[model samples]
Target chain A: MAGIVEFEKHPADTLKVGKGFSLAKADPDATPGYSGNKADGEALLADLDGKLTALQEMLFAESRFGGRKRILLVLQAMDTAGKGGIVNHVMATMDPQGVQFKAFKAPTEEEKSYDFLWRIEKAVPAAGMVGIFDRSHYEDVLIHKVHNWVTPEELKRRYRAINEFERRQTDAGTTVIKVMLNISKDEQKARLLARLDDPAKHWKYSGGDLKERAFWQDYMDAYQAAFDETSKDHAPWYVVPANKKWYARIAVQQLVLAALSDLRLEWPKAEFDVPIERELVERS
Target chain B: MAGIVEFEKHPADTLKVGKGFSLAKADPDATPGYSGNKADGEALLADLDGKLTALQEMLFAESRFGGRKRILLVLQAMDTAGKGGIVNHVMATMDPQGVQFKAFKAPTEEEKSYDFLWRIEKAVPAAGMVGIFDRSHYEDVLIHKVHNWVTPEELKRRYRAINEFERRQTDAGTTVIKVMLNISKDEQKARLLARLDDPAKHWKYSGGDLKERAFWQDYMDAYQAAFDETSKDHAPWYVVPANKKWYARIAVQQLVLAALSDLRLEWPKAEFDVPIERELVERS
Candidate 1:
């Protein structure tokens, strides 16, 4: 636990305070701290860019290789858990075309009419696409389980269903990475309070968000259960400590790189059939 | 034209030929040389990651405000004209929570039953969200105009309809940005050839693409007409010279920064009371 917050740096004075909310800060000296490593992360980010550029060249070379391979990343967490920060840094070095993102909100009436996974399934990446789901079907487990919308038996079924769904995708060559950005209860409260005080972040807060905060313990239990049930070999879940945004991002990027490395991509060879005549054009 | 390809290094040597297709190079120095400025482009790409980071903070801050603003980015171009490259760089730095993207292909049977704009309307970003269209209703102008699927009269009507639709969005506080990535005919030929040489890229190439290639002049005429009619103050089109990927990416990012800066977003103040004091458990 001390390692969770130690690796990432948060400006001690950056905390914001407002009418009803207080920003949370991770106790740096805590046992599980944020030790995922910044230098390593920066290096990895650059590496990911180089790898992707190479992959694009290979993918471009084949031309018919279908489309770009789409990677869907799903990050789910409680309020102030650093999901936004994680998204920013992990995608910091990636080419925009290869990545597509969606943030799931409380289902609209039309969305509710369908199965919980319906809107999300539609957001899945095409053959050569990457889809990032800020919050996903795991909501069924996290919220519904906490609020008792579903019974234990039904919730148990969802866990297995999620596992099967992910397995099928991995088998079909779609990399599904699920990250649970876990933050401490105290830190979450602090972050929420900061949101209320900062004018720029005020729009992200709501009066009702407090209601969810009240059930912090309930959410933790649900998340633990979800993890226990769905952490399969094909689709593994990484428990990312969110108290430190840098570590969370680094961990997620590493996961993405590891998953993409499995594809064994290479640059396609160029065929110069028409007899190349190289003419140099100079710019004055 | 010299400004467009000035710093543009032709990567024809980087073109890979695979099993099914051939790779060719475009002479950027040829007549009507590319029109993008490389120095300006480099400066733009260099600042994109940082600018995007600031924009997301501004967006998050703005969301707290009661009023909502939506940004819809429409991308239209010929195949292999760097649409993917443009999308990749422009939106690369945004917070995934506030940004959403959709790529439209040939309409499905269900989609075909509705007016062409129906599916497109469904894709518009809600308040405080940024929506990106890889290929949009402009297809009705580009493809339909060239293929005669719609009469000249119908095509003319769509221009007005699209204009009004965008104006309505603008009136609703949505900022609309339209980008037309302009690649010369010679560039298209090179890309098509590259696709044939690489086995992996073969999936992206189809024999029918060449059929469209044969009528390059007609497509150009159609595109020029579409640009002339649809370009408006509410949703102006940026004719991006895409012979150079780096230049194209920079141009798009600059355009995005310009649009978002116009919003004048600021971080919201937090409102919580009673400071929650937390201790540093560890320090680096």
Candidate 2:
């Protein structure tokens, strides 16, 4: 069993990338925080639902009540690594009004015309909202790096640009949580085959998935290099073990809870007198 | 029961504005496509789930199969008119992988740096995907016009710019579905008060919502003028009655189904010989 876990420190500190972090060295199935069976993990996740919802609500209220802080959860992974599942199962529990979800696709002609981050900047969650990027600006570094889409010097410039961009977001009160859902290639193959076997899931089965699977090693290398360059104190990357979908969801929910709890958000006091407002409501 | 309804023509043609469209003349409580009670409407919405899912899947598949067509659903509504609910209930029913949902908030420093359509053009749904804009480029006309954020001449220029931008989108095979969620003033008051009453919902209650309420008529005028200028054969605006949430959801679902159906999508054929692939799979 794992040692007694500290809610604030356990998964985040351990999952977070340190200097010279290697994706190859990290196990994709490790459940660092919880030493329990699947049922226990699910129960823990269920308990986290209310806590996450409450923290998100507070953060959202604070935005309107003169709190300028916001949270951005960036989920990056290989195809079929459960990024959508995290958005749906975990983040959806929060009030839809407070969550801003942006799924970045390949750049359009106009998007390519600008610096890569322009579209990303436009989609950042406002104050007091939980902004989720299903796949984010990190794609430019990861995929582009894998395919040599940019020159080595240009890629270096992007690393600098990404750091600067994230620092600016932090300065503007956006707490950025970057998570890479780490799943083994074998696990991905199983999931892909499962989709193919189910007729209803065929729409999601893309030839592109197999094409991308062929480049698995290249992607891992790209991820390693990206972590080496861009994982800063302001916006560090957390490698969440996603083979166990339940654990990944719970870990993400806990990370979010920790981030919001760190903010120490309180419901804003009513600007008007409560006694008078009660009487006024009675009169109305 | 109401008279026979043509799914292709009824709501789209009836709800669409003429040259001199007046917001005041449109009733917020009307349910055009639906001729049943709330329960019945909900049942229809429930029924639409599978159909919409199937259509969306095909659309997504067609994209990967070399189809360049896409659909963009642009939702515009007054405060408390249930845009978020529609997104949650209607669009969320489809696979998130194929949907690109963008909620446009107030312009940021970088967004403000570009022309009004610059950020919007960057977010158009990629091929074979369903893109939803919670609030879109139309805001440049609606809010800006109501508040005189732009001069009359500038507003006229913006109208021209918007029409041109949408035309370009249409020419590029993006079928744009523009909907205005029409709600009564009383409905807005009740919805706003409901938020005030619920502590959990307090975060969604914004002071700007009330501030905008003060200029309700100005907003109506802005909508009327903008709709008159921008609604075209290719991208017509549909003023959906949103007071009945269930009815509104079903109506939007039908419209989306109709749009996808118009695409005449078929299941993409497998590139490999099925018999050969079957043999290989059987051996494996």
Candidate 3:
């Protein structure tokens, strides 16, 4: 808990790795929802942008050679947790060619009848593609627990199922990175209210949002249980402080780049067979 | 050609017609590459965001709904023409559940053997989903044309195929919005050069970038042909100015909102079927 506050209040430079990721401090002035040292966060984000571009180029290069490495980034969070802002700020700089995004919604009747992971399984990125999931299967734990949509026995079974699902994905060579955007309740309300007060933002708000707010404690309990149960070495969850969207986005980016770096992917050498002429080169 | 320039330079505020969209001008001085007059863009984006949210809610209102509507937005552009920025600034705010993104790459042998549209068809949004294509099948026209992938006769056939493909999509209730990010050649070179000069941006550049730059004239010729053949009333091209990334994003948002308004799509209704509980209101 102290680690969380320290990261929230101090610069990222001050962070020392603890058991897993060290939470960085949020910059108050960087952007309305952003948290981190403004200058440091900007620099870190810039670095991330460069790294992601390289990763993307490499992925595209891989595609050219028919090499496929599917990567999945799962962002699971409470509402008003800056998931949207995070996606905009962090993934904004990557080349579109190699990246894909999906936002998991409540299971439809058709989906509800199937296993929890069915819809999500279909969303995994194809070979040489990066897929970002905004609010994923963990919803079963977060929403289902709050709503009592299933028995504790069923929920317990799901934790094992999700673990197996992710492990299978890793075995299949799909790099899975999970992030939990953890913001406090007070901060969550402020954001929700912001959406309600602004007409332009009204579309993002709904009557049901308040209903979810009422179960804040229940959600926290559910999330804690989830992290305790499923934080594996392969697909570990980075507990991001959503109070500052900027720091969270940067943290996520750094984690992603770090993962891709581990893969040591290379760009494909172009095999251009197109007619080449001095005139075309100069004119092109 | 002047009409192209005129349309390119037009600010988003002037374009706000109906459907709660008001063109926004970003404040130029807020930060480098950060729009200052963002309030207006936010307003317009928020309007579209709300409309999209309403549409999704309508489609998924039923827990056991059988069918869903899908929308695909295709963005085709020259290098340094702000595709990434537009995706972040305009469409980034939409709920991820209702939206999907696919960035098509150079064709693999499998894709190359099939018709040009084969890979593109694989990425179209499912019903109730909004699919965004960053650089799509049009690449065969723009880049392939410049590189002479096929003879004039073959290229001509591709144009008709593209026009018909989008038409069939709209007839199937898929709202197809296409944008051609048109930037002056000088502007593009400036951007490319910026990438070269800035160490942080160097990774974004490649050797082929200059080669492609040399073929500017050829690309322009190809794009002109594409525009002439495919700019039908249903799926017209909005030739946006690319010099100002913020303005271009706003313009694209305006075009998207306009299409949604024309469809007169209604918001999904919330079906409250569970028994009312006193605690639910209290908790909320």
lDDT of 2 by residue, B1-284 (tens): 43333243467667887677788999999887556777776766776688898888788888877898999999999999989878877887776667787889999999999999999988899998899999999999999988878998999999899888899999999999999999988788777777677666665656667778878899998888988898998899999998888778878887788899999988776665444433433333
Alpha-carbon runs more than 4 Å astray in model 1 = A1-37, A52-72, A92-100, A110-115, A118-120, A160-175, A189-198, A206-214, A264-284, B1-40, B60-65, B187-209, B244-246, B268-284
* Candidate 1: fraction of native contacts reproduced: 0.38
Q: Each candidate's TM vs. the true structure?
A: 0.74, 0.70, 0.61
Q: Which candidate tops TM-score? A: 1
Better of 1 and 2 by TM-score: 1
Query: How would the candidate models be sorted by lDDT, starting from the highest?
Result: 2, 3, 1
Candidate 3 per-residue C-alpha lDDT over B150-223 given as tens digits, one digit per residue, 9 for 90 to 100? 89998899999998998888787687777767676667766766655554454455667767887877887786
lDDT of 1 by residue, A202-276 (tens): 556665667787788788778767776776666666566667665566566656665566666654433333223
- Superior by TM-score: candidate 1 or candidate 3: 1
Question: CA lDDT of B147 in candidate 2?
Answer: 80
Clashes of each: 94, 0, 19
What interface RMSD does every candidate have?
8.2, 4.5, 7.5
Cα miss at B14, model 2 (Å)? Answer: 6.3
**List-wise, what DockQ does each model earn?**
0.23, 0.12, 0.14
